[model samples]
Target: MNEADFAALRGAILALPYVRMLGFDIAREDGVLRGQLPFAERLIGNPLVPALHGGVVAALLHFTAAAQVMREARMARLPRVFTCTIEYLASPDLRDSYASASIVTRTRRFANVRVSAWQPHSGKTIAAATMQFLTGQMD
Candidate 1:
Protein backbone atom coordinates (compact mmCIF):
# COMPACT_ATOMS: atom_id res chain seq x y z
CA MET A 1 0.00 0.00 0.00
CA ASN A 2 1.05 3.53 -0.72
CA GLU A 3 0.66 6.58 1.50
CA ALA A 4 -2.66 7.79 0.08
CA ASP A 5 -4.41 4.43 0.20
CA PHE A 6 -2.93 3.72 3.57
CA ALA A 7 -4.26 7.01 4.89
CA ALA A 8 -7.74 6.20 3.65
CA LEU A 9 -7.73 2.70 5.12
CA ARG A 10 -6.30 4.00 8.35
CA GLY A 11 -8.97 6.62 8.63
CA ALA A 12 -11.84 4.23 7.94
CA ILE A 13 -10.61 1.50 10.25
CA LEU A 14 -9.54 3.83 12.99
CA ALA A 15 -12.94 5.41 13.10
CA LEU A 16 -14.47 2.16 14.32
CA PRO A 17 -15.61 2.35 17.92
CA TYR A 18 -13.69 -0.70 19.11
CA VAL A 19 -10.57 0.15 17.19
CA ARG A 20 -10.61 3.70 18.44
CA MET A 21 -11.14 2.62 22.01
CA LEU A 22 -8.22 0.26 21.79
CA GLY A 23 -6.07 2.94 20.11
CA PHE A 24 -5.30 0.89 17.04
CA ASP A 25 -3.40 2.66 14.29
CA ILE A 26 -2.42 1.80 10.72
CA ALA A 27 0.66 3.14 9.00
CA ARG A 28 2.47 2.73 5.70
CA GLU A 29 6.20 2.88 5.35
CA ASP A 30 8.00 1.86 2.19
CA GLY A 31 4.80 0.40 0.77
CA VAL A 32 4.17 -1.95 3.70
CA LEU A 33 0.92 -2.40 5.54
CA ARG A 34 1.53 -1.75 9.23
CA GLY A 35 -0.59 -1.94 12.34
CA GLN A 36 0.04 -0.57 15.81
CA LEU A 37 -1.48 -1.15 19.21
CA PRO A 38 -0.79 1.19 22.06
CA PHE A 39 -0.53 -0.52 25.38
CA ALA A 40 -3.27 -0.24 27.96
CA GLU A 41 -3.72 -1.82 31.37
CA ARG A 42 -6.78 -3.69 30.23
CA LEU A 43 -4.71 -5.35 27.49
CA ILE A 44 -2.30 -7.02 29.86
CA GLY A 45 -3.04 -10.68 30.41
CA ASN A 46 -0.05 -11.85 32.41
CA PRO A 47 0.72 -9.15 34.90
CA LEU A 48 3.55 -11.17 36.36
CA VAL A 49 5.43 -11.11 33.12
CA PRO A 50 3.64 -7.91 32.09
CA ALA A 51 2.99 -9.60 28.80
CA LEU A 52 0.33 -8.49 26.41
CA HIS A 53 -2.58 -10.80 25.80
CA GLY A 54 -2.17 -13.32 22.99
CA GLY A 55 -5.49 -12.22 21.58
CA VAL A 56 -4.21 -8.68 21.30
CA VAL A 57 -1.18 -9.71 19.32
CA ALA A 58 -3.30 -11.91 17.13
CA ALA A 59 -5.69 -9.04 16.49
CA LEU A 60 -2.90 -6.86 15.16
CA LEU A 61 -1.77 -9.60 12.79
CA HIS A 62 -5.29 -10.25 11.61
CA PHE A 63 -6.02 -6.60 10.91
CA THR A 64 -2.76 -6.02 9.08
CA ALA A 65 -3.24 -9.02 6.81
CA ALA A 66 -6.83 -8.17 6.07
CA ALA A 67 -5.94 -4.56 5.34
CA GLN A 68 -3.33 -5.68 2.84
CA VAL A 69 -5.76 -7.99 1.09
CA MET A 70 -8.33 -5.24 1.00
CA ARG A 71 -5.90 -2.76 -0.52
CA GLU A 72 -4.52 -5.21 -3.08
CA ALA A 73 -7.92 -6.47 -4.12
CA ARG A 74 -9.55 -3.01 -4.06
CA MET A 75 -12.59 -4.54 -2.50
CA ALA A 76 -15.89 -2.73 -2.02
CA ARG A 77 -16.54 -4.83 1.09
CA LEU A 78 -14.30 -6.26 3.73
CA PRO A 79 -12.84 -9.67 2.99
CA ARG A 80 -13.84 -12.65 5.08
CA VAL A 81 -11.25 -14.54 7.05
CA PHE A 82 -11.27 -18.22 6.19
CA THR A 83 -8.32 -19.32 8.34
CA CYS A 84 -5.63 -17.75 10.46
CA THR A 85 -2.67 -19.53 12.03
CA ILE A 86 -0.58 -17.55 14.46
CA GLU A 87 2.82 -18.43 15.90
CA TYR A 88 3.88 -16.85 19.15
CA LEU A 89 7.59 -16.36 18.93
CA ALA A 90 7.92 -14.56 22.25
CA SER A 91 5.96 -12.84 24.94
CA PRO A 92 5.26 -9.20 24.25
CA ASP A 93 6.20 -6.50 26.69
CA LEU A 94 3.79 -3.99 28.21
CA ARG A 95 4.48 -1.35 25.62
CA ASP A 96 3.52 -0.27 22.16
CA SER A 97 3.25 -2.99 19.49
CA TYR A 98 3.67 -3.02 15.75
CA ALA A 99 3.03 -5.36 12.82
CA SER A 100 3.38 -5.64 9.08
CA ALA A 101 1.64 -7.77 6.47
CA SER A 102 1.91 -8.72 2.82
CA ILE A 103 -0.16 -10.68 0.37
CA VAL A 104 1.60 -13.93 -0.44
CA THR A 105 -0.75 -14.99 -3.19
CA ARG A 106 -4.19 -14.14 -4.54
CA THR A 107 -6.75 -15.38 -6.98
CA ARG A 108 -10.01 -13.78 -7.98
CA ARG A 109 -11.72 -15.20 -4.93
CA PHE A 110 -9.02 -16.17 -2.47
CA ALA A 111 -6.04 -14.49 -0.88
CA ASN A 112 -3.17 -15.68 1.28
CA VAL A 113 -1.50 -13.20 3.62
CA ARG A 114 1.47 -13.29 5.96
CA VAL A 115 1.98 -11.03 8.96
CA SER A 116 4.66 -10.37 11.55
CA ALA A 117 4.46 -8.42 14.78
CA TRP A 118 7.11 -6.97 17.05
CA GLN A 119 7.44 -4.63 19.97
CA PRO A 120 10.81 -2.92 19.91
CA HIS A 121 12.23 -3.79 16.53
CA SER A 122 11.06 -5.37 13.32
CA GLY A 123 13.67 -8.15 13.45
CA LYS A 124 12.60 -9.00 16.97
CA THR A 125 9.26 -10.35 15.91
CA ILE A 126 7.14 -11.60 18.76
CA ALA A 127 4.45 -13.22 16.64
CA ALA A 128 3.63 -14.20 13.07
CA ALA A 129 0.52 -15.34 11.25
CA THR A 130 -0.48 -16.95 7.96
CA MET A 131 -4.04 -16.26 6.93
CA GLN A 132 -6.38 -17.16 4.12
CA PHE A 133 -9.34 -15.00 3.17
CA LEU A 134 -12.32 -15.08 0.87
CA THR A 135 -11.74 -12.03 -1.23
CA GLY A 136 -14.73 -12.56 -3.50
CA GLN A 137 -18.38 -13.53 -3.09
CA MET A 138 -19.23 -10.57 -0.95
CA ASP A 139 -22.76 -10.66 -2.22
Candidate 2:
Protein backbone atom coordinates (compact mmCIF):
# COMPACT_ATOMS: atom_id res chain seq x y z
CA MET A 1 0.00 0.00 0.00
CA ASN A 2 1.00 3.58 -0.65
CA GLU A 3 1.70 6.11 2.08
CA ALA A 4 -1.50 8.04 1.57
CA ASP A 5 -3.67 4.95 1.78
CA PHE A 6 -1.97 3.80 4.94
CA ALA A 7 -2.43 7.21 6.50
CA ALA A 8 -6.12 7.15 5.70
CA LEU A 9 -6.48 3.70 7.19
CA ARG A 10 -4.64 4.76 10.32
CA GLY A 11 -6.91 7.73 10.68
CA ALA A 12 -10.01 5.62 10.28
CA ILE A 13 -8.87 3.14 12.91
CA LEU A 14 -7.87 5.83 15.35
CA ALA A 15 -11.27 7.42 14.96
CA LEU A 16 -12.95 4.36 16.45
CA PRO A 17 -13.71 4.83 20.15
CA TYR A 18 -13.21 1.21 21.14
CA VAL A 19 -10.00 0.98 19.18
CA ARG A 20 -8.70 4.07 20.89
CA MET A 21 -9.68 2.69 24.28
CA LEU A 22 -7.75 -0.48 23.49
CA GLY A 23 -4.66 1.53 22.55
CA PHE A 24 -4.13 -0.20 19.24
CA ASP A 25 -1.13 1.09 17.32
CA ILE A 26 -1.31 0.07 13.70
CA ALA A 27 1.35 0.25 11.02
CA ARG A 28 2.70 -1.39 7.90
CA GLU A 29 6.10 -2.99 8.07
CA ASP A 30 7.93 -5.11 5.51
CA GLY A 31 4.78 -5.17 3.35
CA VAL A 32 2.67 -6.61 6.19
CA LEU A 33 -0.18 -4.95 8.02
CA ARG A 34 0.39 -5.22 11.77
CA GLY A 35 -1.44 -4.09 14.89
CA GLN A 36 0.09 -3.83 18.33
CA LEU A 37 -1.94 -3.80 21.53
CA PRO A 38 -0.05 -2.40 24.44
CA PHE A 39 -0.49 -3.90 27.85
CA ALA A 40 -2.91 -1.88 29.94
CA GLU A 41 -4.48 -2.50 33.31
CA ARG A 42 -7.96 -2.35 31.83
CA LEU A 43 -7.16 -5.10 29.35
CA ILE A 44 -6.63 -7.74 31.95
CA GLY A 45 -9.56 -10.13 31.90
CA ASN A 46 -8.36 -12.65 34.41
CA PRO A 47 -6.73 -11.01 37.40
CA LEU A 48 -5.82 -14.34 38.87
CA VAL A 49 -4.01 -15.44 35.73
CA PRO A 50 -3.14 -11.87 34.73
CA ALA A 51 -3.92 -12.63 31.13
CA LEU A 52 -5.03 -10.23 28.46
CA HIS A 53 -8.76 -10.19 27.73
CA GLY A 54 -9.92 -12.61 25.07
CA GLY A 55 -12.18 -9.92 23.67
CA VAL A 56 -9.16 -7.68 23.23
CA VAL A 57 -7.42 -10.29 21.16
CA ALA A 58 -10.54 -10.85 19.08
CA ALA A 59 -10.96 -7.14 18.48
CA LEU A 60 -7.38 -6.82 17.36
CA LEU A 61 -7.90 -9.63 14.90
CA HIS A 62 -10.97 -7.91 13.51
CA PHE A 63 -9.24 -4.57 13.24
CA THR A 64 -6.18 -6.10 11.60
CA ALA A 65 -8.37 -7.87 9.07
CA ALA A 66 -10.24 -4.71 8.18
CA ALA A 67 -7.02 -2.77 7.82
CA GLN A 68 -5.61 -5.43 5.55
CA VAL A 69 -8.66 -5.36 3.29
CA MET A 70 -8.79 -1.60 3.20
CA ARG A 71 -5.08 -1.17 2.49
CA GLU A 72 -4.54 -4.09 0.17
CA ALA A 73 -7.83 -3.92 -1.74
CA ARG A 74 -7.82 -0.11 -1.69
CA MET A 75 -11.47 0.11 -0.84
CA ALA A 76 -13.04 3.52 -1.24
CA ARG A 77 -14.48 3.29 2.25
CA LEU A 78 -14.26 1.07 5.29
CA PRO A 79 -15.74 -2.32 4.66
CA ARG A 80 -18.59 -3.62 6.78
CA VAL A 81 -17.91 -6.75 8.80
CA PHE A 82 -20.13 -9.60 7.78
CA THR A 83 -18.87 -12.27 10.09
CA CYS A 84 -15.86 -13.09 12.26
CA THR A 85 -14.93 -16.49 13.69
CA ILE A 86 -12.13 -16.67 16.21
CA GLU A 87 -10.34 -19.54 17.90
CA TYR A 88 -8.35 -19.07 21.04
CA LEU A 89 -5.20 -21.11 21.13
CA ALA A 90 -3.59 -19.79 24.29
CA SER A 91 -3.86 -17.16 26.95
CA PRO A 92 -1.90 -14.02 26.30
CA ASP A 93 0.44 -12.83 29.00
CA LEU A 94 0.26 -9.32 30.39
CA ARG A 95 2.44 -7.79 27.74
CA ASP A 96 2.26 -6.21 24.34
CA SER A 97 0.74 -8.46 21.71
CA TYR A 98 0.65 -8.19 17.92
CA ALA A 99 -1.58 -9.35 15.09
CA SER A 100 -1.24 -9.80 11.33
CA ALA A 101 -3.84 -10.44 8.63
CA SER A 102 -3.90 -11.86 5.14
CA ILE A 103 -6.59 -11.68 2.50
CA VAL A 104 -7.78 -15.15 1.64
CA THR A 105 -10.14 -14.20 -1.14
CA ARG A 106 -11.43 -11.01 -2.70
CA THR A 107 -14.26 -10.36 -5.07
CA ARG A 108 -16.19 -7.28 -6.06
CA ARG A 109 -18.40 -7.04 -3.01
CA PHE A 110 -16.87 -9.37 -0.43
CA ALA A 111 -13.54 -10.35 1.01
CA ASN A 112 -12.39 -13.24 3.16
CA VAL A 113 -9.49 -12.62 5.50
CA ARG A 114 -7.46 -14.76 7.88
CA VAL A 115 -5.87 -13.19 10.95
CA SER A 116 -3.49 -14.44 13.62
CA ALA A 117 -2.53 -12.89 16.94
CA TRP A 118 0.58 -13.75 18.93
CA GLN A 119 2.85 -12.30 21.52
CA PRO A 120 6.25 -13.46 20.29
CA HIS A 121 5.96 -16.01 17.53
CA SER A 122 3.47 -17.48 15.03
CA GLY A 123 3.86 -20.91 16.54
CA LYS A 124 2.53 -19.56 19.79
CA THR A 125 -0.44 -17.70 18.42
CA ILE A 126 -2.93 -16.73 21.08
CA ALA A 127 -5.82 -16.54 18.67
CA ALA A 128 -6.72 -16.98 15.03
CA ALA A 129 -9.73 -15.71 13.12
CA THR A 130 -11.37 -15.80 9.72
CA MET A 131 -13.46 -12.82 8.80
CA GLN A 132 -15.71 -11.96 5.89
CA PHE A 133 -16.31 -8.35 5.00
CA LEU A 134 -18.77 -6.64 2.76
CA THR A 135 -16.71 -4.28 0.60
CA GLY A 136 -19.75 -2.30 -0.62
CA GLN A 137 -18.09 -1.75 -3.97
CA MET A 138 -17.86 -3.40 -7.36
CA ASP A 139 -14.57 -4.19 -8.95
Candidate 3:
Protein backbone atom coordinates (compact mmCIF):
# COMPACT_ATOMS: atom_id res chain seq x y z
CA MET A 1 0.00 0.00 0.00
CA ASN A 2 2.77 2.43 -0.91
CA GLU A 3 1.50 6.00 -1.03
CA ALA A 4 -2.00 4.73 -0.33
CA ASP A 5 -4.88 7.16 -0.10
CA PHE A 6 -6.26 6.36 3.29
CA ALA A 7 -8.81 9.12 3.19
CA ALA A 8 -10.08 8.14 -0.23
CA LEU A 9 -10.34 4.51 0.72
CA ARG A 10 -12.11 5.32 3.93
CA GLY A 11 -14.40 7.69 2.12
CA ALA A 12 -15.21 5.11 -0.52
CA ILE A 13 -16.04 2.53 2.12
CA LEU A 14 -18.16 4.93 4.08
CA ALA A 15 -19.93 6.05 0.96
CA LEU A 16 -21.21 2.56 0.30
CA PRO A 17 -25.00 2.31 0.62
CA TYR A 18 -24.87 -0.80 2.74
CA VAL A 19 -22.17 0.59 4.99
CA ARG A 20 -24.25 3.67 5.57
CA MET A 21 -27.35 1.62 6.31
CA LEU A 22 -25.40 -0.45 8.81
CA GLY A 23 -23.84 2.62 10.38
CA PHE A 24 -20.38 1.24 9.91
CA ASP A 25 -17.35 3.35 10.75
CA ILE A 26 -14.19 2.29 8.97
CA ALA A 27 -10.72 3.74 8.96
CA ARG A 28 -7.43 2.84 7.33
CA GLU A 29 -4.84 4.03 9.79
CA ASP A 30 -1.29 2.93 10.43
CA GLY A 31 -1.67 0.22 7.78
CA VAL A 32 -4.70 -1.28 9.46
CA LEU A 33 -8.25 -1.26 8.25
CA ARG A 34 -10.41 -1.21 11.35
CA GLY A 35 -14.18 -1.41 11.13
CA GLN A 36 -16.83 -0.66 13.67
CA LEU A 37 -20.51 -1.54 13.45
CA PRO A 38 -22.46 0.58 15.83
CA PHE A 39 -25.30 -0.88 17.75
CA ALA A 40 -28.79 -0.50 16.34
CA GLU A 41 -32.09 -2.21 16.93
CA ARG A 42 -32.34 -3.30 13.34
CA LEU A 43 -29.08 -5.17 13.56
CA ILE A 44 -30.07 -7.26 16.55
CA GLY A 45 -30.65 -10.92 15.95
CA ASN A 46 -32.00 -12.18 19.23
CA PRO A 47 -33.31 -10.06 22.01
CA LEU A 48 -32.72 -12.72 24.65
CA VAL A 49 -29.08 -13.16 23.74
CA PRO A 50 -28.94 -9.59 22.43
CA ALA A 51 -26.62 -10.49 19.62
CA LEU A 52 -25.97 -8.99 16.26
CA HIS A 53 -27.36 -10.65 13.16
CA GLY A 54 -25.05 -13.22 11.68
CA GLY A 55 -25.51 -11.71 8.24
CA VAL A 56 -24.26 -8.37 9.52
CA VAL A 57 -21.14 -9.99 10.85
CA ALA A 58 -20.71 -11.74 7.54
CA ALA A 59 -21.01 -8.44 5.73
CA LEU A 60 -18.23 -7.00 7.86
CA LEU A 61 -16.01 -9.93 7.12
CA HIS A 62 -16.85 -10.02 3.44
CA PHE A 63 -16.33 -6.32 2.84
CA THR A 64 -13.21 -6.19 4.96
CA ALA A 65 -11.63 -9.06 3.11
CA ALA A 66 -12.48 -7.61 -0.28
CA ALA A 67 -11.13 -4.22 0.69
CA GLN A 68 -7.84 -5.69 1.86
CA VAL A 69 -7.47 -7.79 -1.25
CA MET A 70 -8.19 -4.81 -3.45
CA ARG A 71 -5.62 -2.63 -1.73
CA GLU A 72 -2.88 -5.22 -1.35
CA ALA A 73 -3.31 -6.63 -4.82
CA ARG A 74 -3.47 -3.14 -6.31
CA MET A 75 -6.28 -4.12 -8.59
CA ALA A 76 -7.95 -1.61 -10.86
CA ARG A 77 -11.26 -2.65 -9.35
CA LEU A 78 -12.36 -4.68 -6.36
CA PRO A 79 -11.88 -8.36 -6.92
CA ARG A 80 -15.18 -10.14 -7.33
CA VAL A 81 -15.87 -12.30 -4.33
CA PHE A 82 -16.78 -15.79 -5.45
CA THR A 83 -16.54 -17.77 -2.26
CA CYS A 84 -16.67 -16.82 1.40
CA THR A 85 -16.62 -19.24 4.30
CA ILE A 86 -17.69 -17.76 7.60
CA GLU A 87 -17.16 -19.23 11.04
CA TYR A 88 -19.04 -17.87 13.98
CA LEU A 89 -16.88 -18.30 17.03
CA ALA A 90 -19.33 -16.61 19.39
CA SER A 91 -22.34 -14.41 19.23
CA PRO A 92 -21.48 -10.75 19.24
CA ASP A 93 -23.31 -8.84 21.89
CA LEU A 94 -25.65 -5.95 21.13
CA ARG A 95 -22.98 -3.34 21.02
CA ASP A 96 -20.30 -1.96 18.81
CA SER A 97 -18.46 -4.67 16.89
CA TYR A 98 -15.06 -4.51 15.22
CA ALA A 99 -13.16 -6.41 12.58
CA SER A 100 -9.87 -6.60 10.61
CA ALA A 101 -8.67 -8.50 7.57
CA SER A 102 -5.40 -9.68 6.05
CA ILE A 103 -4.31 -11.23 2.80
CA VAL A 104 -3.65 -14.94 2.97
CA THR A 105 -2.57 -15.91 -0.54
CA ARG A 106 -2.46 -13.73 -3.62
CA THR A 107 -1.46 -14.70 -7.13
CA ARG A 108 -1.73 -13.11 -10.54
CA ARG A 109 -5.50 -13.58 -10.85
CA PHE A 110 -6.65 -14.98 -7.55
CA ALA A 111 -6.70 -13.82 -3.97
CA ASN A 112 -7.65 -15.13 -0.57
CA VAL A 113 -8.14 -13.15 2.61
CA ARG A 114 -8.84 -13.87 6.26
CA VAL A 115 -10.99 -11.75 8.49
CA SER A 116 -11.57 -11.69 12.24
CA ALA A 117 -14.22 -9.88 14.22
CA TRP A 118 -14.78 -9.07 17.88
CA GLN A 119 -16.14 -6.64 20.35
CA PRO A 120 -14.24 -4.11 22.41
CA HIS A 121 -12.94 -5.55 25.71
CA SER A 122 -14.36 -8.98 24.79
CA GLY A 123 -10.87 -10.48 24.43
CA LYS A 124 -12.37 -13.25 22.30
CA THR A 125 -13.13 -13.53 18.63
CA ILE A 126 -16.79 -13.43 17.68
CA ALA A 127 -16.39 -14.56 14.11
CA ALA A 128 -13.96 -15.20 11.24
CA ALA A 129 -14.09 -15.71 7.51
CA THR A 130 -12.01 -16.80 4.53
CA MET A 131 -12.84 -15.16 1.25
CA GLN A 132 -11.82 -16.04 -2.31
CA PHE A 133 -11.96 -13.57 -5.14
CA LEU A 134 -11.21 -13.24 -8.84
CA THR A 135 -8.70 -10.44 -9.38
CA GLY A 136 -8.90 -10.54 -13.17
CA GLN A 137 -5.26 -9.47 -13.53
CA MET A 138 -2.01 -11.08 -14.45
CA ASP A 139 1.24 -10.05 -12.84
Candidate 4:
Protein backbone atom coordinates (compact mmCIF):
# COMPACT_ATOMS: atom_id res chain seq x y z
CA MET A 1 0.00 0.00 0.00
CA ASN A 2 0.95 3.58 -0.54
CA GLU A 3 1.74 6.01 2.21
CA ALA A 4 -1.76 7.39 2.46
CA ASP A 5 -3.34 3.95 2.42
CA PHE A 6 -1.03 2.62 5.11
CA ALA A 7 -1.68 5.61 7.26
CA ALA A 8 -5.41 5.15 6.95
CA LEU A 9 -5.20 1.50 7.90
CA ARG A 10 -2.98 2.22 10.88
CA GLY A 11 -5.38 4.86 12.03
CA ALA A 12 -8.25 2.44 11.77
CA ILE A 13 -6.46 -0.01 14.04
CA LEU A 14 -5.83 2.72 16.57
CA ALA A 15 -9.54 3.45 16.56
CA LEU A 16 -10.64 0.02 17.72
CA PRO A 17 -12.15 0.07 21.19
CA TYR A 18 -10.57 -3.18 22.29
CA VAL A 19 -7.17 -2.12 21.03
CA ARG A 20 -7.49 1.13 22.88
CA MET A 21 -8.84 -0.62 25.95
CA LEU A 22 -5.91 -3.00 26.02
CA GLY A 23 -3.51 -0.05 25.73
CA PHE A 24 -1.82 -1.58 22.72
CA ASP A 25 0.03 0.90 20.59
CA ILE A 26 1.12 -0.79 17.39
CA ALA A 27 3.18 0.96 14.77
CA ARG A 28 4.51 -0.26 11.45
CA GLU A 29 7.08 1.02 8.99
CA ASP A 30 9.14 -0.69 6.31
CA GLY A 31 7.35 -4.03 6.78
CA VAL A 32 8.01 -4.20 10.50
CA LEU A 33 5.77 -3.56 13.48
CA ARG A 34 6.82 -2.54 16.99
CA GLY A 35 4.27 -2.96 19.75
CA GLN A 36 4.29 -2.20 23.44
CA LEU A 37 2.41 -4.22 25.95
CA PRO A 38 0.99 -1.99 28.61
CA PHE A 39 2.42 -2.65 32.06
CA ALA A 40 -1.00 -3.01 33.52
CA GLU A 41 -1.46 -4.79 36.82
CA ARG A 42 -3.40 -7.45 35.02
CA LEU A 43 -0.26 -8.66 33.25
CA ILE A 44 1.98 -9.08 36.29
CA GLY A 45 2.49 -12.37 38.13
CA ASN A 46 3.66 -14.06 41.30
CA PRO A 47 5.70 -16.70 39.41
CA LEU A 48 4.89 -19.38 41.99
CA VAL A 49 1.24 -18.75 41.26
CA PRO A 50 -0.68 -17.88 38.10
CA ALA A 51 0.03 -14.18 37.84
CA LEU A 52 -0.31 -13.65 34.12
CA HIS A 53 -3.44 -14.93 32.50
CA GLY A 54 -2.81 -17.16 29.50
CA GLY A 55 -5.67 -15.49 27.66
CA VAL A 56 -4.08 -12.08 28.08
CA VAL A 57 -0.80 -13.30 26.68
CA ALA A 58 -2.63 -14.93 23.80
CA ALA A 59 -4.44 -11.70 23.04
CA LEU A 60 -1.16 -9.82 22.85
CA LEU A 61 0.29 -12.38 20.51
CA HIS A 62 -2.81 -12.29 18.35
CA PHE A 63 -2.62 -8.54 17.98
CA THR A 64 1.05 -8.68 17.12
CA ALA A 65 0.54 -11.33 14.50
CA ALA A 66 -2.37 -9.48 12.90
CA ALA A 67 -0.35 -6.28 12.65
CA GLN A 68 2.51 -8.11 10.95
CA VAL A 69 0.19 -9.62 8.35
CA MET A 70 -1.41 -6.26 7.75
CA ARG A 71 1.95 -4.63 7.05
CA GLU A 72 3.09 -7.38 4.72
CA ALA A 73 -0.23 -7.64 2.90
CA ARG A 74 -0.66 -3.87 2.98
CA MET A 75 -4.40 -4.38 2.96
CA ALA A 76 -7.10 -2.13 4.34
CA ARG A 77 -8.71 -4.82 6.47
CA LEU A 78 -7.07 -6.34 9.51
CA PRO A 79 -6.25 -10.02 9.33
CA ARG A 80 -7.96 -12.45 11.69
CA VAL A 81 -6.21 -15.07 13.81
CA PHE A 82 -7.30 -18.55 12.74
CA THR A 83 -4.96 -20.49 15.01
CA CYS A 84 -1.99 -19.98 17.29
CA THR A 85 0.31 -21.65 19.78
CA ILE A 86 2.34 -20.02 22.51
CA GLU A 87 5.22 -21.16 24.70
CA TYR A 88 5.98 -19.41 27.90
CA LEU A 89 9.68 -19.39 28.58
CA ALA A 90 9.22 -17.49 31.77
CA SER A 91 6.63 -15.32 33.43
CA PRO A 92 7.00 -11.59 32.97
CA ASP A 93 7.36 -9.42 36.00
CA LEU A 94 5.60 -6.10 36.48
CA ARG A 95 8.08 -4.15 34.41
CA ASP A 96 7.43 -2.90 30.87
CA SER A 97 7.54 -5.42 28.05
CA TYR A 98 8.17 -4.89 24.34
CA ALA A 99 7.62 -7.13 21.37
CA SER A 100 8.22 -7.34 17.65
CA ALA A 101 6.13 -9.45 15.33
CA SER A 102 7.40 -10.67 11.98
CA ILE A 103 6.00 -12.66 9.12
CA VAL A 104 7.29 -16.20 8.99
CA THR A 105 5.38 -17.27 5.92
CA ARG A 106 2.44 -16.31 3.78
CA THR A 107 0.12 -18.06 1.39
CA ARG A 108 -2.73 -16.86 -0.76
CA ARG A 109 -5.27 -17.11 2.03
CA PHE A 110 -3.22 -17.11 5.19
CA ALA A 111 -0.08 -15.87 6.92
CA ASN A 112 2.19 -17.29 9.60
CA VAL A 113 3.70 -14.89 12.10
CA ARG A 114 6.07 -15.17 15.02
CA VAL A 115 5.96 -12.89 18.02
CA SER A 116 8.31 -12.72 20.98
CA ALA A 117 7.81 -10.79 24.15
CA TRP A 118 10.79 -9.61 26.20
CA GLN A 119 11.45 -7.84 29.40
CA PRO A 120 13.95 -4.99 29.20
CA HIS A 121 15.61 -5.59 32.53
CA SER A 122 16.32 -9.26 32.01
CA GLY A 123 16.50 -9.29 28.21
CA LYS A 124 14.88 -12.71 28.39
CA THR A 125 12.07 -13.99 26.28
CA ILE A 126 9.06 -14.21 28.48
CA ALA A 127 6.85 -15.68 25.81
CA ALA A 128 7.06 -16.83 22.21
CA ALA A 129 4.15 -17.36 19.87
CA THR A 130 3.35 -18.53 16.38
CA MET A 131 0.08 -17.47 14.84
CA GLN A 132 -1.78 -18.21 11.64
CA PHE A 133 -4.00 -15.50 10.25
CA LEU A 134 -6.83 -15.70 7.76
CA THR A 135 -6.30 -13.16 5.05
CA GLY A 136 -9.67 -12.57 3.50
CA GLN A 137 -10.25 -10.56 0.36
CA MET A 138 -9.68 -6.89 0.83
CA ASP A 139 -11.83 -4.17 -0.63
Per-candidate local distance difference test: 0.83, 0.88, 0.80, 0.74
Off by over 4 Å in 2: 121-123, 137-139
Off by over 4 Å in 4: 1-6, 28-31, 44-50, 137-139
Model 2 residue pairs with clashes: none
By lDDT, the better pick of 1 and 4 is: 1
Ranking by lDDT: 2, 1, 3, 4
Q: Give one digit per residue, the lDDT tens place, for model 2 in 6-86.
A: 788899888888999999979878978898899899999999998888899988898888888988777655689998889
- Model 3: weakest 10-residue lDDT segment is 1-10
Candidate 1, residues 52-134, lDDT tens digits: the string is 98988888888778778878898644578999899999888888999888889999889999899998753578999999999
Models ranked on TM-score: 2, 1, 3, 4
**TM-score: model 4 vs. ground truth:** 0.81
| 10-57 per-residue lDDT for model 3 (tens digits) | 566667789889998766678787777888999987878878999999
Candidate 1 least-lDDT 10 residues: 1-10
| Number of the top TM-score candidate | 2
Write one digit per residue (lDDT tens) for candidate 4, span 1-139: 5667667766867777877776777765565677776777756445567456566666667777776787788766678778888998887766666678888888888888889887789879888898888886544
What clash pairs does model 1 have?
none
Per-model TM-score versus the true fold: 0.88, 0.92, 0.87, 0.81
